[model samples]
Each structure stands twice: as structure tokens, then as C-alpha cells.
Target: MVATADLYDERGEELASLPLQLRDLGGVAEFSGPVRTIRCFEDNALVKAVCATPGAGAVLVVDGGGSLRSALMGDLIAASAVENGWAGAIIHGAIRDSIAIGGLGLGVKALGTNPRKSAKAGAGVVDEPVEIGGVVFRPGATVWADRDGVLVER
Candidate 1:
């Protein structure tokens, strides 16, 4: 559970910092794990499906195309993540029910909050490399996030 600042100081050249000013919305302040990615836009069916599976302490990295018009996840999916043992979630988009999600025992970082939920078209790619904020979040890459920011390492 090293602080983001310390991690950066120790591995400044090796880690890639997520440049977006993501908000810390979950109860847990620090979380890190191997990356699991989803690439979609305004659809959350895959997000729900992934959260239902066993996380094995991995972090779900959702590439929502940086859209703030709709939410890709909410309280229910986040609760599922906790129940299934996901270490955390880093969403490159919006999320709803921020207040409720903040109470859950999961680490969630997102671009911002929105009240409108996303569609359930079930259209998206999973376990793929998703680039957000100039970082390519590939499957199996390790990600760490704290109040300072997120950092990724291959």
C-alpha cells in the first residue's frame, strides 16, 4: 500500500502516470492490481458482466471514451465488484450514484459523476488494450491509484 507519491519517487521513470484528474469516489483510498480492461462507450452491460465474475484481486479498467453524458457504472455494479473481490475500478468516464458508491468497500476512480445511467446494449470489447489519458491500459499490466493519482507499469 505505498502512496502514489512514494511509488512515483521510487519508480518515476518506469511508471506511467494517468494524466486525467480523476476523482476518488470509493471508500478505499488506495488500490493496486493487475489490469483488466473493457472498451466501450455509453454501454455498461459488459461492465456488469465483468464485475459478476471473480476478480482475483485484479483491477477493472474501463475505457468509456471519456464520455460524461452517461454513466458506465453505478452502485450496484460496484457492490458486485466488492462481492466478487475486485481490488478496484478505474473508469475513464462517468459514473452514477456517487454517494452510494462512496459508501461501498471498493476503490473506484472515475473522471466524474453523472446521474444518467448508460445503455445495456452489451456491445463492447473485453480484455483488450484501452488507451485513456495517454496511457494504454493493457491486460495484465499493473495499476496503482491513490489520492495523488494513478500509475501504470508494464
Candidate 2:
């Protein structure tokens, strides 16, 4: 994968800078692919539903409203992402079971970890445009993420 810094250097100000304190929660530190967006606050039913489908090397970008109160993802959902062929997951909310998640091959970046689980109400919007850290994530855009940061190419 190309380094995000290099990509930034090449694109310069044209590239949208994704400023977030997302930690590398999964085993892989860097990952990139076409984005698939999900807008959900604290419910994870929509997230689980997406993880169940074939990812086709795409990245699941979840706009959880940066909620640290509850974990939008956990070990099982992350495992599903790996099994379903997702390149990575970027969550604006929280996740749980960091140790277990780090064991998986999937690339996961999130704000932080929480012990509480999310509501399973199946309430959320899929494939919607989500803005995070001054960056807008739209479905079908190629997103490059690495140790430096995340970038979006429309």
C-alpha cells in the first residue's frame, strides 16, 4: 500500500485531510479501499448487517457520532468483517475487546474502546454520506488510510 504521507505530498492541498485520533485497533496498522458508509449513533444492528455481507475489499466507514458511551463494534462483528472480505473498518464511535480485535487480520481504526455494548435496534442509515474530522466520506470513493491518517479520493 502507498504511504498516506506520500499520497498527501503528491496531491497536496487537493486531498481532504482526515483529522481524527483513531487508533489502530486491529492487527494491521494501515488499510485502504473503496469506502462504504454507515451513519449510526449507538445502535449496531446496521453495522452487523453490513459485516454479514461480502465486502469485496471495501472499507466500512461508520459514523457513530463519535460516541464513546457505547461500543458500536465488538469481537464478533470485527471477526465477521474479516471473514466477509472487508479490507478494513473505520469507526467514529467506540469498540470493545481490543486484544481480541488485534488478533484478527482485518484493519480497524476507531476513537477508543468501551465496555458497554451498543443498542441492537437496527436503526441507522446505510451508504449515506458522513462527515468526520473535516472530511466527507461518500460511498464508492477510494479511501487511503495509514499511520499518518485517512484520505478520501472522490
Candidate 3:
């Protein structure tokens, strides 16, 4: 994958740079694919369900409302994502099992870590446009991420 910095330079005006300083928590340092979004707060039922389905190299973009109180994803769910062929995930909230997730092949970027798991009330919308850091991650738009930052191809 191309570095985010180079993509920005080559097509700065055509991309929307995600403004979050997310950390790379998974084994892969970079990943990119068409967007698949979920909007939730302190809940990950939808996240888990979506990851269980075939990803076909799409990136799951979770708008978790920036909640650090609980984790939206953990090792098990991440493993499911990898098995289902997801390219990566960008979580706008917390995740658990960082060390274990780091050993998996999927790329995971998130705000931070927490040991507490989120509620499973299925309180979220899937495949909808999710906005984070003033950028809208619409389904079908390509997203690229690396150590530098995230960029949405427009």
C-alpha cells in the first residue's frame, strides 16, 4: 500500500484526511479498502456481527463516538475480521486485547485501549455513513491508512 503521506502529496485536494491521531494496534501497519461503516456508542454487537460476514477486503470503519469507557472490539472479534478477509479496521473509540490483536494479520487503528468490554445490546447502525473527526466515511469510498494518518479517496 502507498504511504498516506505520499497519497496526500499526490492527491491532497482529492482526499479527506482523517484528523484523528489513531495508533496502530494490529500486526499489519497499513491497509486500505472500500468503506464499511458502523455507528455506535459503547456497544459492539453490530461490530461483531459485521465482522463475522465476508469482508472481501473491505475496511470496517467504526464510529464509536470516541468512547474510552469501554472497548468496541477485542481479539476474538478481530480474528473473525481476519478470517472473513477484511483489509483492516479504523475504530474511532477504544479496543481491548491490544497485544493479542497485534499478533493477528488485520490492521487495526484506534483511539486507545481498555480492558472493559462494551455492551451487546445491538445498539448501532451498520453500513451507514459514519462521521468521525469531521470526515464522513461513506460506504463504497476507499480509505487508506498507515503510521502517518488516514485518507479517504474521493
Candidate 4:
């Protein structure tokens, strides 16, 4: 992929940027694809379910309400996504198993890392628009992430 800086110069106003201070936690440095949104709070059942399916080169955007109490994703779920051919995962909340995920060869970005796992109450809404840190991640939105940052295009 080209540098986001160049994409900015080339596409100009065609791209919309996501404003967040996310950190990379995956082995891959860059990834892009249409979005599949998940809205949840301190729960990862829906995240697990969505990622287990074949992504077909799609990005999973999980809105955990920026919760730092528990991790919305971990090595197990991340590995499942990769095995199912997911392109990447973007979490609006914390995640665990940073070291394990970094070696999975998957693209993952999250606000931070936590040691605690989330609840399994089968909570959260899937394929819904999620707003995180003042940024809206809607379904079907294109997501591009590189060393520069993560940007969205409608």
C-alpha cells in the first residue's frame, strides 16, 4: 500500500479521516477493507461471533465504549479472525494478549491493552454504526490504516 500521505495528496477530499490515538497490536502494519461494525460495552461475545466468520478481506470495527475495565479482544478471538480470513480488527476499547496478537500476522489496532477479559453475555449490536472518540464508523465504510494513521472513506 502507498503511504497515507500520498493517498491524501492523490485523493484529496475524497477521504475522511478517523481521529483517534490507536496503537497497533498486530503483526501486520497496514490493512484496508470495507467495515463490519460491532457496538458493545465491556463485552466481547459479539466480537467473537463476528470475527469467527469468514471476513473475505473485511475490517471489524468494535465499539466498546472506550472501556478500560476489560478487554474486548484477545489472542484467541484475533486468531479466529485470522483463521477465518479477516483483514483486520479495529477496537474502540482495550484488548489483551498484546504479545500474542503481535505474532499472529493480523492487523489489529486498539486504544490500549488490558489483562482482564470481557463478559460473555452475548451482548452488543452487530452491523451497527459505531461512534468512537468522536469518530463514526459506519458499515460499508472503507478503512485504510498504515504507519501514518487510520482513515475512512464513505
Top candidate by TM-score? 3
Candidate 4 residue lDDT tens string, 15-124: 76777879989999899999999989998999999999989999999988888899999999999999999999998899999999999978999999999988999887
Candidate 2 lDDT over 43-139, as tens digits, reads 9999999998999999999999999999988999999999999999999999999999999998999999998988999988999899998799999
How accurate locally, in lDDT, is each candidate?
A: 0.94, 0.92, 0.95, 0.88
Candidate 4 accuracy as lDDT: 0.88
Cα displacement (angstroms), candidate 4, residue 68, comes to 1.2
Q: Which residue ranges in model 1 land beyond 4 Å of their true spot?
A: none
In model 4, the worst 10-residue window by lDDT is 12-21
lDDT of 1 by residue, 12-101 (tens): 989999899999999898999999999999999999999999999999999999999999999999999999999999999999999999
Give the better candidate number (2 or 4) by TM-score.
Answer: 2
Candidate number of the best lDDT:
3
| TM-score-sorted candidate list, best first | 3, 1, 2, 4
Clashing pairs in 4: none
1 or 4, greater by TM-score = 1
- TM-scores for all candidates: the values are 0.97, 0.97, 0.98, 0.95
Each prediction's Cα RMSD? Answer: 0.8, 0.9, 0.7, 1.1
Scored against the true structure, residue 116 in model 1 reaches a CA lDDT of 97
